[model samples]
Target: WNKLPLAVQTTESLAGSNLWDVPTSHLHPSTNFSSKLFWEPQCQTQLRHLQDRTRITATIPPRLDGHWVSSRCEVRAGPEFLTRSYIFYPTRLFKAFQHYYCDSNCHVPAYSLIIQGKLRLRQASWITHGATEAEHNLQKVTLVIHNQWAAHRLETRLPSSCLRLGSGVQLVPSKLYELFNAKAKRDCLGALHFSMMELDLLRLEIQYHPLHQPSKELFLGDVHTDQNQRAHYRPTGYQQPLQNTMHHIHPCPVCALMYQSSEQSPPILPPSWSIPLNLNGHWISQRCEARPAVLFLTRLFVFNEEHHTWEGTYHHYSDPMCNHRTFTLVASGHYARMEPSSKVQGATELVFKVIRAKVTMFEQTMLQMLNSSEEGSCGQAGGWEPGAEQDITWTAGCGMLGILLPHKEYELFKMEKDHKNRSLLLIGERPTDGSSPDRPVKRPTSFQTPMVQCSPDTAVPQHYSSRSDVSTGPEVSSAIIHHSVFSIFLIVN
Candidate 1:
């Protein structure tokens, strides 16, 4: 026992310290306390397995007095149980000690798994959807399992105020994609629902309960009676099953082409009716070791404004041994094109915008007059049109209209399902002040006052033409216009 591994020795001594087998002598300060692993290694193995698998199916041993720790005894009889069926009561000291051990084992990965026969959240029950396994980066001294509640139950239903739909606020389509991605990572059910009036909150939570009914067990832990009962982790508020819950799972090109060739398919419309401007692309790259990811691609979709419809696809791959890549489609114009490709990386804009009539007219007039070109080389699409089909379109549907709001409200953003659920949130009515003609308007969060467009009675470029025109009624000139050369020229005059 004295020659055993230091960790094993210490653990055994701690467990056996109260025993009468110790020699009757003044306790030696130099006694070998490190040889502690002599007791059953079952506890160690179970702890290690629970940590690695992200699940708790450990077998509990009998106590030294030949009795069991009530709640833990039943867990040993049958592991496949729920609520009070399986519990892990690691003392706070044990977790604190694990911190140093985890640091020393810098490269090791940590996983926590909780498996049961049936899982229930809200009114829905999932018989086969418990987490199979999870892996995490262990380099950090303390790791917080965010969205831990996902394994236990879904988020609480948000209050009625959160269901702000078609209130002129837009929910960025990209943000909804992200919410789904987080759901997959934590193995929690990610649900979003809205039908003009009903709503659901995006929720993430985690917890552990005993295997057996605690009615027979002695009381333990300092229970807080004054705590909010409503906050005690329960699913509330039901939603109708989504008609097209799998909205974004796309078929491969082969399948898409086969379907297209087999049927008399309609011509595919672009993202919007008007040609897009500000065509640009950007890239981001990151890497992780022994840690959970903070970002990943979750969903992709294409909005056909003409048809007022959306077709999309989804992917959920989150394993520590796997590599991740994300491709984003972003543009500003009448119709924002979400270009389709299997591998969406490193693809440049192959085609330029089509030529507008005004820009074409300007170019043709210059050529007919035989004047040297001043616009250098005009793209196929040239010249800006005020009120012409701007590249992006904002129709007045409930869900479509909410696309402009901040991402936090994605779960609350919903369109009417009875009719075609098109992009309800569309980009319409440029800042009418005529200041910075093509600039986009900024949306405010709950943190600040909302910005509104100038009313019909308010004057535009005329009233805001000079410093004297500044109004004290919480009205500030558009930031983009304030920095524009046109604004400076008008002010100087």
Candidate 2:
């Protein structure tokens, strides 16, 4: 806590009192999120096992007993789009509402699940530091189908054993009906192959604002990404975060609308955006993003409408808040014609290629590590210096950094606008397991967080370009090459 700001220290210290009891994985000088040790798939399970040996039950923080609402539509591994609204009682009784949607932006309502249970806080998590471990038991489960379309969609997923899917599904428009009740012993979850156990794992993150309102974010256990592995897998990561209602100030006004409209009926979510006629502009991440494998990053992209060319700059950091710089990956390429996605209703599909790749080391340690790598593995034999950009397109990608040089990726894109009228670019979700979406069958069904386009569109030199395997878009202004002045120009400044 001492490493955080004074505001965080004042409030968070009062909540826990004992700073030593909390897990601070990245706070130590020796801890490096950039290292291979931190991102390994088995590292999370290993940390949990070690922490469980010395586990001790702790009291649930008083501030946790309140209403929490989703700040945005969340995408799970099953590519499920949903919104979560939950309340925690002082008596340890909990009620959670999950509103499912057909589209990634949550415009099309599907159905809703109401889950009531008893939650017990157990211990601190060693994996997602500053989070607590908890267990829960389901008392009741209620499913409310929103419309005929939603009912039809659910019916397709039900196994043959669950023949009760059709009886109560036929309904009038603009009405909600209970399709399944725990008291009825429908065995719907077993038949549908779904589990609500993802709710038991909990993490509370407090964002402090000394001058104004401070807010807390709730991170539930992540749902298994693979549909088949979901039933038995315990969540290791987290889904999208939720903002609290009572002890609240998350800066997103929609959070309140979600809580209010969730009372009687499903809220008609406003500001539903579509792909713009022209996507030629500069788009940047609105905030620092935390992803799987303990990686934290922010992306900046420049697109030219006249040429249909795109350049993406990825800035990687070691800290959760994007305060500590580690390295930068520069990928430049062009996209082909975007066809309407057959799988996802509103998303557009295209292919992105990385004609050239460059890496820039931000720390002296990173430079030394790259210089020590075997010849042609990371880059050239020597001369690796911090801030000096080096081309790694020939060796495919920087081996030391674990970056892959896939020939092309089937990317999905959607254009959206926020309530504030800011243009947003939504890209396909990269596989969390560190695999490339090179094949058509591997195209993403869900989208990542929307990137806000820079207002008035900043101007950058148009030289960097990546060539797609199947060229279908407008002709390029220049030939695609690995070594170009544009690549250096983009990374240096």
**Of the candidates shown, which would achieve the greatest lDDT relative to the real structure?**
2
Off by over 4 Å in 1: 1-230, 235-392, 396-493
Worst 10 residues of 2 by lDDT: 476-485
255-363 in candidate 2: lDDT tens per residue?
A: 8767785523655565555655456766666545555444445666766655556666666554434445455676665567668877665668887766666776665
Model 1 per-residue lDDT tens digits across residues 1-493: 2332222111001122321112111112222211111212332232233223222111111001111111110000001110111122222011111100011111111111212111111211111011111111211111111132321221243222232334544332112211212223432211222111111111111112345211111111111111232123121111111111111112112222212210112112112211222211111111111111111112222233332222211111121111221111121112233342112111111111211111111112222321231232221123322212111112111121112211110100111111122112111111112222122112110010011111111110111000111111111122321222121111000
TM-score of 1: 0.15
The 10-residue segment with the lowest total lDDT in model 1:
73-82
Candidate 2 global TM-score: 0.71
Model 2, C-alpha of 342: deviation from truth (Å): 3.4
By how many angstroms RMSD does model 1 differ from the true structure?
31.5
TM-scores of all models?
0.15, 0.71
RMSD of 2: 12.7
| Cα lDDT, model 2, residue 440 | 85
